[model samples]
Target: MGELRLMKGNEALAEAAIRAGVDGYFGYPITPQSEVIEYLMSEKPHERTGMVVLQAESEVASINMLYGGGGTGKKVMTSSSSPGISLMQEGLSYLAGAEIPCVVANVVRGGPGLGDIQPAQSDYFQSVKGGGHGDYRLFVIAPASVQEMSDFVPLAFDVAFKYRIPSLIVSDGLIGQMMEKVELFDPIPRLTDEEVIARYPWATNGKPKGKERRILTSLDLDPHKMERHNWALQEKYKLIEENETRFELIGCDDAEYIIVAYGSSSRIAQKSIQLARKKGIKVGLLRLITLWPFPKKPIEEFVKNGIKGFLTVEMSAGQMIEDVKLVVEGRAKVEHFGRYGGVIHSPEEVLEALEQKLIGG
Candidate 1:
């Protein structure tokens, strides 16, 4: 094990960014997630790792800052809640279209519109289906534990740089506020200006002599050129889908029914699985790790093996269920169960839903 400590999810994530060698953090404080910026401010990473931490005037400014900095091959990121994230959609879209490397964390709160400062997974559709206006999808990760919240920052940055894609870590108030033990990774070295340019030739850092001209923009006046650019993006997304689809299977081999969930809901489902198994119900858990490049292949495999049904559990009324439906394609009986208004469901509630919605429905 490396460095280990007990910490809140938001603080762990903040520290992980420092160790991940992040160049900068530009964000406005929002509930639950505000702790991320607060921790960074308290730590003063400027003194520690030469990391620049700035409290942007607004979410709009924060994302635009990312647009500017990320285009230069810098590892910059931000965190926000539901309403705050909504304000950054246009900038997020621009970054996606330009294929800039960056990370975003959404410690979600209740919302269709500033609902509350409680944990919620209501942003599933907004996250997976592309929150911003466009046909682009973020490289999305859903952390089920404080450990994951700590670890995925580096992973997101690595993936972002590798593919020149923006990554979104889909966390929530539960994971953000909860405290747990996390083993932190050793610090990575930040890239120098020359190293960044050497590694990422597409970056428009400066007009360096004897180097290729690099233009970073999401604009195209000619429709035909734009069509080609869109096609190229679609091909890249397909490639990511092939290589980066991530999920987990637990107690699934002999299971007759399965519970599909991600992030916080997956943690609750593990207990539900235990309760179900004790009652002689053969239920298993399917945990989604990557939300965008969804692990469709695993679900398809389970369905082919003739699993009776699947129950998609979430804090939202019903968002991820649509994806489950799309993946199962009506072959298996799939239903949704959840609590709305920032209320988290209990294990008993999940077990009950499995019986009523999947097992016996």
Candidate 2:
């Protein structure tokens, strides 16, 4: 354990990856995630801890490199923003199909085109709802602050390896560029080559000792096999939903209205909660950390607690609100508030929305 130091979110992410003992890093630079690669470059973890860090030619190649590294059972990761991540979708789909365990960070920017370099949560669907083509789910973790950026990286790695599935940390420019105090930890133990080989005898390489060549793939031409594979994937997703839901509760335990937010939007919502509290509005908040699993249980619990309505805030065109509505299941009215294409929702704006939608007439 160590004391917290002020560091930008991207730098914190890099430090966390290094501390998490990632074996390899393959990424193409994109704002605001570029600092992550820069930190890895300047830190030169390969020289220090024998980690491999490589800036690839493009996002496509970078994700493919991740596939190569992760296929070998080494703890590997990559980072990119929306456009770059979009390019990596093919590889991400492939990785998911093969059930390869790895970490990916998307410091999201405004999107659909070049978008903007500023903060945006437009990638919520891309992350939580599977950006790539597949009947698969990526374990998506959303971090509202730099603290979560540092903390979630190691957690993502742990979850990926445990499930042998891909895990993603979906952050944004606000968290990535902002500086905050972070408590650093010592590097976790890196898996030795022999150890990885032992665990992934099926990883693409020469045959393991006394074992035949193992092929890692997601394609099954046979209908029966494909159905079985899909069924298995569904089962895995259920396990994830049950064991992986994560959220932070504020005043929902005894409130009439709940605010559902995640990522940077959640940060704004927190301030709004305090402001609402001072005005005697019995407002509470549920900040989602794991966006993919969607933290449905907590929202359901709020509904059970007699919460009447929710304000779903984001930096996108109301993508997450749909998920909230699904979970609310008619027990609570859910409304959306957002600013898209690089515009962020400020605390004042959220407070206004709360007043108009949930807090006032």
Q: Cα RMSD to native, each candidate?
A: 0.8, 1.3
Best by lDDT: 1
RMSD of candidate 1 to the truth, in angstroms, is: 0.8
Against the correct fold, how does model 2 do in TM-score?
Answer: 0.97
Q: What is the lDDT of residue 178 in candidate 1?
A: 96
**Model 1: how far residue 241 lies from native, Å:** 0.4
**Which residue runs of candidate 2 sit more than 4 Å off their true CA positions?**
none
Q: Across residues 1-361, which tens digit of lDDT does each residue of candidate 2 receive?
A: 6867999999999999988999999988888889999999999998877888999999999899989889888889999999999998888889998989999999999987899999999888888788789898999999888888999998998889877789999999999999988988777878887777777665775675787777789888998998898899899989998999899887776678888898889889989888988988888888988998888888888888778789999999889998989988887788888888998887888888988977564
Report lDDT (CA) for all predictions.
0.92, 0.88
Top of the candidates by TM-score:
1
**Clashing residue pairs in candidate 2 (N, C-alpha, C atoms within 3 angstroms):** none
Off by over 4 Å in 1: none
